[model samples]
Target: MIDASLPEKLKEKISSFSDYKIFTHKNPDGDALGSVLALKRILEFENKSSEIFVFNSIGAHFYFLPGIEEIRIQKEFKDGANSPALFVLVDCASWGRTGFPFFDFAKKEVIAIDHHPKRTDKEPLALEIIDLSASSAAEIIFALARELNWKIDPEISFCLLAGILSDTGAFKHSNTTPKALKAVSALMKNGVNIKKIADNLFRKNEFPGQLKLLGEVLARASLEPRIRMAFSFAADKDMKRHGAEEEDLSGLANLLSGIPESRFSMLLIETGAGKIKASLRSETHKGVDVSKIARLFGGGGHKLAAGFEIEGKIEERFEMIKEKIAKESASWRI
Candidate 1:
């Protein structure tokens, strides 16, 4: 069962508010957007005024989601327009993750919902619903919907299903628990098109350039047999050479994690000069907590998958991470 007190408190807060603004992290994935959109639809169904505030463009793969067009970027959101009484943050672990203009907005009543491990560095908010055991923030949303006794229409089902599917790697990831599977079954009963959502999320229609980039990154992958870990890096130059964007690097870590001998995999991308984004993933049975490695660099996520950003030369950062990982893996009996 889920936490009763948190959902009940959120229900009371949601009931008291007529206008609300939803916020998610920058470069939002399906879990982030899906959770936000699903919540927005629910509030609107109750005759509450709600809008989602996100920065950056969503991935093209998510275009099939209902109400996808209504999402507004941070720049487009006008300040003080509706005087929203409540700010609902979904799939975001910390206030800083909300990005840009929304982050600048002074503290109002906040309801933060997420499945990621909490960062002790960040202070607690007015209402926080965090269940790291849940597969995704969408899973928590599904639970909340049940607690509120809201109707689960097809659109809502699709949104929540997408979130859960995406975050759990289509239910193949380690976080996919029995409860998550039960939730998916319920969503399917609500008329969610499972095959269509799965195809859209997992089967990407790759452009030639993206294919080239993927090949290049994979061609240079390094395997550390001692730790049963593999890693690869892509520089901005490499992206330009292949005519690929940062989004094209989406599944690189997952791809690498599938290596037969790899207990974990890491993918580092040069987002900008002297800035690197690192993604990490580990096999569920490896007994390695990649999230701990990520936390050492000020990032937080699930044990199997996590990521962090560093400001340094790609080579320098990679070496630093390698050393850190090596030290951490030294204690492993594998």
Candidate 2:
């Protein structure tokens, strides 16, 4: 949970910053992108100049966002002696995710604004503002803007709304708090099209994407009959054969979680050459914590929605994981 006294620290930084650069996680999700843009808009309203860096074609989905034209890639320009003096990392915990090329140069002046649960102070971070209870990092930004009474333009609202909608899977996830709803209500009031955003995010899909989804559900899927849970996996080859993209698989993991009698659901996709990307959900199971499993495999997420990756031949190692998960399932109860 983020400390209530966090605002005082944010205020202190705002008072001192002349110029800053905003960064987000690699493959930046909607929440990550939205947080960066929302923060930039707020600072701009205060006449504080800033720049945003979106890495790995994160800006490719520009149509969904408001001011996509202004977002830049850090590698395209040089950071000189007088360039941005501060770096703001949004929706990212560790430094590796922050796409800023000059991270070592900007380490002392970086600020981390995220909403993931934490156990302790991650060493070497300058300013940390995290509140897992808030749902989206955008929600935290909303609270910060209100605390500072900063002007939130319609564009800012759009950014924040994008973050909120994306992270909560359009309010399907458990993290959607009352405060999140209230923040979204304000964004809607500020002219964000809730319908359009939801449609673009959830409904829009090309033929290839549709085929990818169909193939995944029809072929790759498996059901743990004992737990009433269904799962599936898509290897890089599967994606290539169906002309698939990562965006196409973004929420496909949730499909199996809807089983009528399910206690839990999961999915694993081979995203990397030697890595098996996983999605573990607690659906109706209360006795298991996927986070513990994820930690064992060098990944992390919430108890209800955790993920991990394993190294080796995707098919060969998957059986080992399934056996381990079955053992864990034996100890599980609704």
Candidate 3:
């Protein structure tokens, strides 16, 4: 069931601010893009003006989503210490997750809308409409709209559905819940094209470079027998050689997680600037909580899916991951 109080509190908080800025994690996925876009539309529906901001580039696979062009890209957020507008973080809560840990939130009011597990760090600045049981942040956004009696347009419907589809892996992941499916059914009733969403997300839009990169990464995949973990890495050189972007690595971790012998899977990509992006996935049925592993490195997400970034060479990070898994595996049920 949706929390009755959250929407009311959000409505109250939003009324206090005339302008808003929406943010999501860096290297955003479908859910991050979806939820942020949908919320922008929702705010408009409420007659509230808002803008979307994100760090780095978004994947081409998501170029088909509505309102894709409006999102302002930034290398980092400028100081907002004196800004009066409220900041709404979708899909992730912590500033570190947004890839800007030092962003000034000193006296700024903030709201966090996410489906991930609660963070152990400092709490949100204002309202937090978080549902750990939600399949995706898009699902939470849809419920939020329903709770507040806000009308969802066709564009907003597509955005929400795209997020739900992206995070649920087209309803294939274990996180696919009845409520999520019901939400999809309701969104489709608004005349959104599910085929277009599916084709772009999974099949039709894949470019030659992305395919080559996938094959190369798959060939290098290594499975640790003792821990039942499948791991792989894509060097920055390889990414450049194939012309593949960060978004192309989206589903690779989930693919590795499909190995029957593996309880969890991880994909590490060297994303230049001495930084490595680690995407982690676990078999929920196997009781492997990858988020715990992510938290140890200052990242967080759902138990079955989480990620973090590190500063170093890929080899060193790979060794660190292996060691963390070896030590952490003793606590998880195989």
Candidate 4:
């Protein structure tokens, strides 16, 4: 059953303001960037002014998307006494996920559009369009455009298709659905280059630095025979030695997930001083909910893919995390 009220409400909320601020999670991925960029284009079509804010710099791979240059690398929220502006959180539910605090300087309405499962402790922003069944937030954005009777321009199609391709892994992931395929068909009709999108996303990371980083990750990775899991860690030194950027580590967990016998994979990277980031991945057929594991460590994402960050060295509590993963997977049939 489709709840038509949410998009209708989104339309209403969007119509209420002329200026808007769009946000996505930190270290924004393809789906994150794609969703926000597409929304920015949509707002422009409606004659609304908008700006995109990302906490970290995006990878060069996504620079091919339209309007990539205008993204502001925001450090802090500097809310002033400007005219009323709507804040739209795309691909995430809370402002905290944007790697920034929710500023209470003014009374403003926020709308969260996401495809992740609804969080029980989400922020007070209620104009949400969360669809867990959708393959990607891009899918939800396309649906909203259709519901609001907005034209799907070429730029919007490019951005949305980039997002869908990203989350679906070029229609290879388990989340690929008939709706996603239909969206692809429509976007193709709009003349989006699937080959270009795929090449940029998957093949563009074949440089020497990324290769060295991959070698380090693979060499350090360990396979837990008991749980059929693969795990590894990359520290600041490893990244520096390899000249690898954070974007280079993006698909390492998925690479580990390709191990034939492994049911789960995790990659830990030291993102900042005393701060470690963990990426977890499992196959949909394996029936492992990585998000549940992430939630245990104060982070969340989809079932097959999720992540969390902790304030400590990579080796500080790795054994403890392994114990938690073991306990979590104990009930699995695999």
List model 3 lDDT by residue over 120-238, tens digit each. Answer: 45744687777888999999999989888888999999999999999888998887999999999999999999989988887755689999999999999989887888989999999
Model 4: lDDT to the true structure = 0.84
Model 2 TM-score relative to the real fold: 0.85
lDDT of 4 by residue, 161-208 (tens): 999999998899888999999988998899988898888878764779
Candidate 4 Cα outliers beyond 4 Å, as residue runs: 81-83, 120-122, 327-334
Q: 304, model 1: CA deviation in Å?
A: 0.9
* Runs with alpha carbons beyond 4 Å of true place in candidate 2: 59-62, 74-84, 99-107, 119-122, 224-229, 260-262, 284-287, 324-334
Q: Which of the two, 1 or 4, has more TM-score?
A: 4
Better-scoring candidate (TM-score), 2 or 4: 4
lDDT of 3 at 51: 90
| Descending-TM-score candidate ranking | 4, 3, 1, 2
TM-score of each: 0.91, 0.85, 0.92, 0.93
| Candidate 3, residue 82: how far the Cα is off, in Å | 3.4
Backbone clashes in model 2: 0
C-alpha lDDT score of every prediction, in listed order: 0.83, 0.74, 0.85, 0.84
Candidate 2 worst ten-residue window by lDDT: 98-107
Could you tell me the lDDT of residue 115 within candidate 4? 87
Error of 2 at 225 (Å): 5.9
Better of 1 and 4 by lDDT: 4
* Ten contiguous residues with the weakest lDDT in model 1: 99-108
Q: Candidate 1 has which clashing residue pairs, if any?
A: none
